[model samples]
Target: MSEQLVEALRGAVGDGHVLTDPDVVEAYAVDWSRRFRGPVLAVVRPADTAEVAAVVSACVTAGVPVLAQGGNTGLVGGSVPGADSAPTVILSTRRLTRLDPVAELAGQVTAGAGVVLADLHRHVRAAGWEYGVDLAARESATVGGTVGTNAGGIRVCCHGMTRAQVVGVEAVLPDGSVISHLGGLPKDNTGYDLTGLLVGSEGTLGVVTAARLRLVRPATGSAVALVGVCDAADALDLVRSSVPRGVRLLAAEIMDAGMLRHVCDVASVPWPLPQQHDHVLLLETESPADGDVAMDLPDDRDVVVALDAADKARFWSYRERAAEATAVLGVPHRFDVSVPMGSWDAFVSDMRARLRGIDEVEEVLVFGHLADGNLHVEVLGPEPEDERADVVVLAAVADHSGSISAEHGVGRAKAAYLALTRSPAEIATMRAIKAALDPHGLFNPGALLPSGPASPSRSS
Candidate 1:
């Protein structure tokens, strides 16, 4: 049956695109974090939406599960197959690379699922516009994967998440029916919003083949400032004050001295400030070139202004290389959480105190998008210490009415912890949705919601 499934996939896509070699398929079996892996029947590379539908149809006929993967750069275990589940086939969208003309769509651009996020940004930028969402993994992250996770990044403070930019989508449902709505309409109240549903389904319901993304005009003028603050509250206050009424804030990122110093050392970039402070804030303000916007940040010695594009990129590079720097230092239990804006400071304080108290915890580094109340915490230590710290961090986030997983979706790794943020009723509703869409669970199998008879779990 497995061999027949492979033969069917090859017929659907192409003989050359169907890879059954363990050496080649192994790379597609794991995720970016190397956290989850599973046995795959074969890796099928589909060139377009029709091919994806054909491949999914073949899996449906064979009673086999199908896992959809894009760039395979998801931090959570969403893109990887379930290790404990029956062998499933991976549908790689790398060959579905097509970027529609910007003029045709006016304020939007339709891109295939295989198009890289960074590449889309560049294509749009050439037309005097931008994709709006900016992530450190843009170069490797695909449009479909980002849309699947509803990704939020550094520019989310101003532009919002991938959901906000996804005006339309093209997907193949579990039954192999293609749902196409790749039209950027300002108002479309025709029926249920399947496009929105597919945006963050994480491949459980269907495969996202392409997307029509909303674009925004480039800021005529922009300024970036690095400021040292007393604490998270101080940094929040500055973020509020720095943005004038007319000016648009591109981003407001906060990083601790430990994280900043580590990134600087790894990137070999000079510290912009003379003395390292406990909290570092990267604030940016932009407006039309003809419009005048005042930058009224607190006057301090640590505040360094980036006068040009190169300087601004240099300052932003420090924040962009944070994850790589931490990885270089060592593997650590990592978390991406968001709390109420009011409890941001308290949550950070509580988490720091709790993590530091753990004997196994060697170091706790923090940084994130301050404007949106999302924080990325990295706890470095042995498995014993890091695992304990994970508990403490999740508890703290919940206590502050925060989400255990913020921008990053609740993939299989975070499935059990969904209770920390969602109530039992909410979880049940999610499960019901999953069952309604993919009744046989032929899609991702185990992911998102908690594992049960209704919905199984992906192997850790």
Candidate 2:
């Protein structure tokens, strides 16, 4: 970053909050994926919305690009900073956290962008209410980052993804204007819906400061059934019949056998007997207090955790630990793709066979929120530090009519390949829309859009 940008950042946020040290900036340089790290002028930690706005405004004036980051647990290279990327400032959304709790029957709770997902769950769950999104990175992924990526985790089957749960949003436009329609009146259909436009913009459209998200009562009873299937196709059949169990089906997850072995090795969870099957699916169900069915059946599922605090944590740990397990193997290529549900059987078989035939590839681990047709793949191999494998795997997703990302935002890491799934005309429209919201291309430039790609229809 240039001296002018550093001076402006220091002025907006007190000197104590502005970090220009190479050591500190280096820490925020890369994400969990370690894919594409960029050059950073400084790391600005804002304490409140005002400070956040000030920092953003200063970056615009100085012509210094800004990258909004949260817990840095993102698998995509979205949060990474690099040196080739001109002078830039890293806006760390770490300090803007506050819990605003409302005790109404609907149980409304507003959280700051920096509040971690898991902590938000614990805060409201005591009222028999809960924040619906659950992911392995819940402990680290902040509300702002989750909203930026529209994250979908294990609960997607029953509760839906983050975008579905976000009834309101509070973001700062490129010009540092705060647009507060966060969880606004449900009946206001007077104009176009701008909240949806910003939610999945990947912080390229604007910086998300806070959100009014949907909250539901914690399931009175919950259970997880680990089922072994002979092939990937069999897993698809199970989901079609099992998901309609109504609210009882909290999540329906699938995992490859290779992943299970890694899970057993890295986590406290044990492996199955001599045979755990090549493909496995974990079906989760829930029961409300009025029904109380979960309490009545003890051996109903592979994993069950009721209102008991300890029991719930134990079962959830196993599912969320998949990321950690794969991370230990290597910095692998990961993608979140969504395809037609019916083609899952054929897609899995074909992709697995094709990947297996490649000598450059070593192992493949697949798991995700199957309910949304969103699959997460951690493609890795014996080659210890190989990183390009992720890029190759992502490009291959386009061949299957799958998205480059099922939920995770197209942060800087995926920015280079976003066009693979989106068509030329669609990309042109995107550029036009981006120009409307961020005219000079100042808001998180170089992300979500290739420097030369066209923009889409933007409302806000």
Candidate 3:
């Protein structure tokens, strides 16, 4: 980076906000993925939307690439910059944390972009309201990042993803212009739903400053159970038999016996898993919204407090610490894939067979939201450079008319296989849209799209 650009940025923001020191720069260079390292010129932490706009305009004029990051907790490498490539400045969103509460005419609370998700949950619950989006990374993940990924969670089947909760958004475009679409439009056939466009664009289209998220009334009662199945086939059958009739299945996460074993060994805690159970299915379902009928529920809310809050959390510790445990085991390649719910069982079987063939693959952990069919597969050790090797699992997932990515965005990690999910026409339209929004390609370049048929391997 040129000294003049640094001086300009220092002039724009105070010396306290602009970090150019090598040690400080290194801290913000990589995201939570730890899959890639970026050589950034500096990381600028702006206080508000105006400051973000000014910094962006400065970077645009300076011909510098600006990589926007929030919480540094994205699974994808969307927040990473190149080390040997042209100077890219990281724009961290941590400093922009703010939550504004509002009540709609229909009576709902909308929050800002920077609010931590778990805090939001507490806030809404205290006020006797609810915002349905829940995820494991609630502590570290920001509301902005969640909205950016349109993040889905354990509650996805009952409510929906982040896209559904967001009624309005206040975003900054690539050109340093603030597009604050805050007013809740009940119905608008006026033009393209720009809010929808920006939601899952992975920061390529724009920066989400704030969002007017939709709210719901709290669930009156809930039931949680660990259903020990004979096998993965039986696990799928339990889902088919139970859900859709009365139970509003909030979550149905599947953990293989190997995963259970790994979790037990890592945490050194006795998991509440059934003996000799091939597959462990942890499910959560809700009772009526009315408090009166909730007590009548087969498993009342106390069951929820006991199982989910205590016993469930004890067992759930294994699931929560899966990422950390796997990191300790060996190098991990996490493939966040999704398919039609109907094909999840078959796809898992096929994937297990393929992975069993690989001598390098020490352990393959399969677990995810079965109702939504978004499976997170972690391959432990041995980096396979072969794209053909990649196709075994990728093709199995694609066989179900599913996506290459469900919650995690298509960053450089999966850019090579992004096309397997979307058609050529769809990808072309996406590229055209990207070119239109970011004419300079200054925002997180070489991500969400492959440079060519073959791309560079990830190195954290």
Candidate 4:
């Protein structure tokens, strides 16, 4: 049966594109975090949307599950097959590299799923524009994958998440049907919002092949301010001060001294501040209004303002590389959760104490987009219980009425604790939608939604 399935995929794509070599499949077997690895029947690289649809159709007919992959850079093990699942075909969109030329006048561009984010940025920048959302993984992350996860980055405070910029999506549904909504219209109140549904579905409902992304004007003038705060409460206060301001806030990032030191040591860049500070609030504002926007924070804190581009980049590099630096130090159990801005300080203090209670939790590093209350916590130890840590923090986040998973989707890592964020009725509704779309459960099995009694559907 596996042989027949491989042949069918090979026919949809090509013999050379269908990879059965264990060495070749190994790279696609595990996710970026290297947490989940599974046996894959084969890896299929489709060149175009037609090939993707054909591949999906063949897999559905063969009764083999399919895991859609783009750049294979997801942190939550979304692209990897589950360990207990049957042998499945890993669908790679690497060859779907077609990208429309940048439309400077329209402020938008349509790009295939395989178009790397960095490449897209370069193309857009050539036309004197920029993609709204940018991530540290832009070098390897694809537009489709970012859209699938509804990725949020430092710029999210200003430009919003990937979902807001996604004007249209082209995807192959679970039943091998191609749904193309590449209109890029500013207004469309038609039927169901299939585009929104698929954006954060994590490939469970459909495979995102391409997206028409909205572009925005690059900042004409920018300024950065690194303020040393005493604690999370002060950081929150600084964030609130930015509100109802004249300048456009580009990013508001908070990092501890430990995070800054680690990134500086890893990058060989000296810390910018003259004195050591426990907590640093990195604030950046950009505007087309005029010269550098005057930023005046409370006089109690030490502040360094960067009017030049070079200095601003230096400060941002530290905040942007927090996760990478932590990874370089050790593979820490990481959590990207968000609470309300009001509860940001309390939640962090509580979660920090809770994490310290565990003997295995060697160290805890906290940082994130403080403008939006999404905190990225990294914990290191001999053997970190990621799931246990997730539960502990998720419960705390719930108590504060916050989200369990912020930018990163549940994937397999947070699937077990999704109940903390969502109500039973909400989960049931999601299960029903899943059953209606993928009745055979052939697409991305064991992701996002937890497995439970099948919801009633038309087929049933």
Candidate 5:
């Protein structure tokens, strides 16, 4: 069966595009965090949507599961196959790099799933527009992967998540049928929003081949400020009081002192502030012609504002280089969760105390978009397979009336604990949708959905 499937894949895409060698397949089998890996019969790279449809058709006929991978930069185990998955073929989207010219009149662009986020940013910026989604992994993260997870980045507070930017999508469903809606219409009022449904489905519904993304006008004269704060609550208060009356708030980020120090050491950059406090708040605001927005901030606490572009980049490096620095400490159990605004500080305090109590938790680093109440938690000192830390952290999130998964999709990491955030009825509806779209379960099985009965609800 493996031989026949390989032959079919080779026929759909060229022989050279289908890789069966163990040495080469290893790179595509594992995820970015080096946590999840599985065996693959072969890796097939398709060039266009038609080719992707053909490949999916072949795999469906062969009774083999297909895992669609795009940049493979996902921290969760969604983009890659699992260790116990059946003989699967990784449908690589790296070759589907069709980027259409920017629709200047509509302020949108249609890009293939394989198009890197950084490249899209450059392409749209050249047309006097911005993509709005900016993250550290922009250089390697692909459009389809970001769309698959509905990624929220630093600019989410300003421009909203990927779902808002996505106007249309072109995908190949589990039955090998193509759905193309790349018109970029502003008002469709269509029956069942298929694009929105697939945006955060995590590849369980279908493989996103291309997307029509809405672009935003570039910000004019921005100023960045790094201020010291006592805690998350203090940071939130500072964000409200610091910005001037007319200045527009673009971003608000918060990080612990320990995490900031680690990032500074790993990046080999000088500390931006004079005195470090327990937590630091980074704010980016729109400036006027004079570019003196930082002058309006209160002088009570330590503040370092960057008016020039170079200085702003330097200040942002501390926040952007955080994930890279955490990776240096080895594979850390990473969790991206969100709590309510009122309970943000208390959740952080409670979560930190709970994590410290764990014997396997050696170090805990916390940082995230402060205004949005999303926190990225990285825990070190646990083996990759040890899930004790997962239970402790996710359970605490449920206890605080928070979501188990925030910007990042459930993937296989938090699928079981999904019931903690979602009710049984919601999970059943998701399953019904899954059955309607993918009855054979060929598109990304064992992801975004729990395998067994939903766990009892724990949310307050």
Candidate 6:
């Protein structure tokens, strides 16, 4: 059966595009965080929407689970196969790199799923526009992957999430039917928005082939400032008080002293501020004039602002290099969650004390977009397979009335804990939608939705 499925995939997408070698397929089987991995019969690369539909159709007929992967940069296990013994094939969308011309008047562009985020940024910037979303993995993160996760980055407070920027999408349904609506309409009173449904579905409902994305005008001039704060509350207050009245706040990020020190040591760069503080708040705003933007800020606290492009980039490195630094230490159990503003400080304090009690926890690093309550928690020393730390962290989030996931979707990593954030009825509704779109349960099974008993015919 595996041989026949491989032959069918080779027929749908060309023979050369199908990879069966263990060495080659291994890379596609693992995820970005290196925590989840599973076996696959073959890896199929589809170049266009037609090929993707054909690949899905073939897999559906053969009763083989199809996992649609774009760049394979997902931190959760959604983009990769699971540990189940069910026969699976990974459909790679790296070759679907079709980028259309930017529509200057409409402020939009259509990009294939395989187009990298960084490349799309450059493409629009050349046209005097910018995409709202920005991430540290921009160079490798693909359009489809970001859409699948509905990624929110530093600019989310200003431009909103990936769902806000996505005007339309082209996707292949579970049964291999293709649905496309890339018109980029400003207001479409369409019924049951399939584009919105697929934006953050985590590939369970369908495979996102391309997206018509909304673009924003580029800022004329920007200034970045790094301010030292005693804690999260002080940082929040400073953000409200500081910055000129007319200037628009572009981004507000926060990092703890421990996380900063680790980033500096790993990146081998000096701390931007003169003295160390418990936490640092990085703010970027549109500059009203040419002179230093930091000068306008009250001189009551330690503040370092950068107007020069090079200095600004250097200052941003401490926050941007955080994930890279954590990866260097080893594979850490990563959690991207959101807590309420009022309970933010208390939640962090509670988590710090709880996680430290665990013997295996070597270090806990916390940082995220301060304007929003999203926090990226990285814990070292727990084995990749260990879920003890996960329980402690996610439980704390639930106790604080916070969500289990913020930007990263509830892939296999957090699927089991979906109940902590979502109600039983909500989960049931989601399951019904999954069943309707994928009755056979062949598209990305065991992701986003929790696992249940396998059916007689299909093993999810």
Arrange candidates by lDDT, highest first: which order?
Answer: 5, 6, 1, 4, 3, 2
Please write out the lDDT profile of model 4 over residues 51-141, one tens digit for every residue: 9999999999989999889988888888899788888899888888888987666788999999999999999898888899898888999
**lDDT for each of the candidates?**
0.84, 0.73, 0.73, 0.84, 0.89, 0.88
Lowest lDDT sum, 10 consecutive residues, model 2, at 295-304
Give the residue spans of candidate 1 off by over 4 A.
287-294, 384-387, 453-460
How does each model score on TM-score? 0.94, 0.88, 0.90, 0.94, 0.97, 0.96
lDDT score for residue 449 of model 6: 85
Q: Could you say which candidate leads in lDDT? A: 5
Across residues 74-143, which tens digit of lDDT does each residue of candidate 2 receive? Answer: 7766775543677568888888788787545545677888999888888888666878888888778999
Q: What is the C-alpha lDDT profile of model 6 across 1-460, one tens digit per residue?
A: 7788888888888899999999998999888888889878889999999999999988998999988888887888888888873757888889999999999899999999999999999999999999999998898999999999999998998899999999999999998899999988899997998898999999899999999999999877788889999888988888888766767889989999989999999988988798889999998887655444732567778888785888888989999999889988999999999999857789999998999888999999899988889999999998988888998899899888888899999999988888878877888899999999999998888999888632111111
User: Deviation in angstroms for 432 in model 3?
Assistant: 0.8
Model 1 backbone overlap count: 0
lDDT of 3 by residue, 320-386 (tens): 7766777677556777888776777778778889777777777778887777878888887557343
TM-score winner between 2 and 4, please give it: 4
Clashing pairs in 4: none
Clashing pairs in 5: none
Question: Residue-wise lDDT of candidate 1 within 1-460, one digit each (tens)?
Answer: 9988889998998899999999999999987766578889999999989999999999999999898898898877888886787888898888889999895456899999999998998999988888888899999899989998999999998899999999999999988899899878878999988888888888898999999999998888888888889778998888777788878888899899889989989988887787778888998888555224347866654788886778888989988889888887666677889988867778888888877778878888889999999999888875622356766888788777888888888777667677777877888887888888788888988778767643322112
Candidate 6 TM-score over all chains jointly:
0.96
Better of 5 and 6 by TM-score: 5
Error of 1 at 209 (Å): 0.6
